[model samples]
Target: MHRNQGLYNYLNEHSWQITEDWYKLVNDEDSESIYSTTDPEIIQSLKEQNQDYFQHLHKLFIEKEEDFFRDFKIWSEELAKDQKHLKTPVQYVVREFMNSQEVYMKYLKEYFSLNKDNVALDQFLSWIDLVRRVVNLSIYIYIEEANRNTLRQLIAQKEIINELSSPVILLRKKIALLPLIGDIDTARAKIILENTLSQCADLRIEDLCIDLSGVAIIDTMVAHEIFHLIQALKLIGVRSTLCGIRPEIAQTAIQLGLDFSHIRTTATLSQALDRIIAD
Candidate 1:
């Protein structure tokens, strides 16, 4: 029989004992591990996952076939995306994999000692290489999946922040209030312009009161974007009224040679509201 086949058969026959001993070692060393928790369901689930991993690992060793490795890769990818695994820290997962590697190596060493007449040095070296390859691939998949999950979360958060920063609250049937607060940068100005125009169209807002009372500073680019937003609103048949234009902002707009004669201005949101009511 082939050396790999002999090793595979030995491991497959003792898979149950290996898994049990591996879990015991991990639990004994890692008391705070999610797998070592007292919850029966969680513990059972972790056992099942470990068993699945071992089954695929055994197949990979026995077959040494491309399809077996492909299936193992797919299974490892799924495990990486698993909610339970994702919740665990990457360090903990990595440590667990390292422990499993140690356990497998110890078991193989024992197996070699018992079957010294049958197991050759080259065969032992081949088995070690296989173990290293599997462990390295598993770690790579885990880290890649974790990075993807983090990136997905960051994108979701950015979308939410963009929406919150450019809110349009409807005060009346045809009037909406867009309160602009904080410093206006070019990027934020673009988001503000796009979201406000889209919301105004969706809400059928004829008059939009843009309150800038909380805004502290504005640059030339930001002032130009504001004017562009007003022009865009006009094209879509929504009249924009600028409210609470602080002295600094007004001075900056003037310094930039921006013409605001076509845009309506108010001292406060209340005055803008009064004008809307009178109209």
Candidate 2:
């Protein structure tokens, strides 16, 4: 038998034992909550994943001269997307990979101690190098997937926030209330303007009560944007009523020489509703 084949047979025979040892090592050092599960099914699933990884790794060792293992690469990508792995802290995943390498190296050392005459030093070194390359590839794929998942979550959160910030509540037929709250930066103001116009057109809102009681300040540019938003609503056949303008915002608007003569103003949302009801 070839020297490489002998090594492969040894690894294949002891694969289960190595997997159990690796699991024990990871379970004992479970600080990141990745493998510290009480559920039997979860524990079994983790063992299965580890076993699959080792099996793929063993195939690579048997064919060390190959440029890449397409099957293993595909499996690694799928493993990266696994919900359990995705939820696991990345540092824990990295440490687990390190732990597996250490286990395999220790097993190889033990195997060669008794059969040192059977394996060449160069072949042993090559196997160690192959293990290192596979671990590195797995780490790279895991990190890339984690980053992509994080970015997706951030985008989802932003969309939810935008929807919440510019909510158009329909209080009556042909009437809606848009209560502006918190700080309105340029980006948020733009979102508010676009969402408001789209909602008004969809709801066929004839009168929109825009309350600014929650808003504390508005610079000239923001004030202009608000004015432009109102003008845009008018063009879309929606009459926008400005309400709850704070003293500071109104003063800024005056300083900018913005004419609010054509725009209807209300002191409160209830009063705006009352006027709409009375009219």
Candidate 3:
């Protein structure tokens, strides 16, 4: 039982005591019998209610604390496995949080820190907010990595297309060799040009061998794009060499009056490689 005088003194600084009428917890329900009793019963009843409220509050505070650590533990484990999934700023924030000595230090400290001298309830609440941010940051990184993996799969597909662009006895310089497969249409041509040009530029390669070995037809647009890429390469100081143009491409080239004079032509990738290697 809280002594009326003592309980009042102990809770003198507490806002709950001042705002006693505001609480449904303490004032809720029929406490009239308890509130009405004289002497020891009234005081005892109020103390019991106070104690019960304190007990419930204390338990909730403890559970909240445990829950904070629980969230932190799960976040830490996942963060350890996937840090890149975290926000760039949050990484530093977490590092500071973990390195705090007055806070949860060591590995925990390195992840987060708080100054002990300024330990206040508000500060503790802020720390929890930061902890939640770190967890969210880790989740973001995980999603980013997952998205990147999917993109990589698509990139691998492009790489495969590049390989087929040219038929070769050998592959060199990480060129996106595209041996034309299936439909050799205008759409395919555009994709090839864009992909090839992008790879060549990104790689900063001087020599690109585009072998039309598998092209079903030597269409007007395909020839135009090939020459276009060749010119783009020259402008960028990259040299594009055509290889594996069967009789069909030659005939089409002649028929279209397409000038192959500025472009180097090779019968096969082997010949192109040999010439490039020689140069």
Candidate 4:
């Protein structure tokens, strides 16, 4: 007989009962948690997830420790990525895992009491150790995966914001407006340069007015990128005009020794457009 045969049988028979007990005792007061959800579908999904966890967990009694933990890792990773669990506050999720640990501890004691003659002290202690190790490791893995998901989301959002920040609007036939606003960091400037070039090509822009009136600050690197963008536009058969060059930005450009002799400049968007119409 397997060393933990009786314990395995006991857990298998009581799996549903354990899941029900866990659901009844769960604290879902946090409004951010899926556990606090009112939708019947979500609630039912939550119960099913709890039951699934128990189905994986009870195998520890019968399977080799290494095999059980390997399977548990797969299960834990899935939980970390679960749409409902991901939306839930991490604290609430971890709290439920701890609660499940408490339930396991309770059942361990009951199982021992019913079979004390056969359950040795060493075996009982080993099971306790295994339980604690699994719980701690599960929490660690969940938090690690959760952090990765958050970082992915942040990167995706930043990409969208970057695209939105550098928009090229068509002002007229074969003419377009590239309006730059806010602080121009080197990273953002690179995206602007790439996006502006792509947009000008797509719009078949001949005369491009880059408006910088809304921009509050510019560093040397950003100033360089702007010139690079204008030079890029010229290579793509687009005529470039710089408008609304603020005093601070001009000073930064001058300090960088940028040659503006060949560059077109205007004090306002209206003036730039008027110049384009006259030409």
Highest lDDT: which candidate? 4
> Candidate 1, which segments miss by more than 4 Å at Cα?
1-3, 27-33, 65-67, 183-190, 254-258
Error of 4 at 272 (Å): 0.6
Residue-level lDDT tens digits of model 1 in 195-216:
9999999999999999887888
What ranking of all candidate models by TM-score puts the best one first? 4, 2, 1, 3
Q: 133, model 3: CA deviation in Å? A: 50
lDDT (Cα, 0-100) at 110 in candidate 2 = 81
Candidate 3 per-residue lDDT, tens place, 147-183, comes to 5656777898976775566332225664435455554
TM-score of each: 0.87, 0.88, 0.38, 0.93
Q: Which 10 successive residues of model 3 have the least lDDT summed?
A: 101-110
Error of 2 at 153 (Å): 0.7
Model 4, range 55-154, lDDT digits (tens) per residue? 7878888888888889899888877788777777789888988998998888988999899999888889888889889899888988898888899999
Point out the worst 10-residue segment of candidate 4 by lDDT. Answer: 1-10
Model 2, range 57-169, lDDT digits (tens) per residue? 87765563453456667789988998777777888888888999899888778877878897777777877887788888899999999999989999999878987989999
- What do the candidate models score in CA lDDT, each in turn? 0.82, 0.83, 0.52, 0.86
Question: Model 2 Cα displacement at 173 (Å)?
Answer: 2.2
Candidate 2 local lDDT, residue 31: 50
Superior candidate under TM-score, 1 versus 2? 2
Alpha-carbon runs more than 4 Å astray in model 2:
1-3, 28-32, 64-66, 69-71, 255-261
| Alpha carbon lDDT at 75, candidate 2 | 83
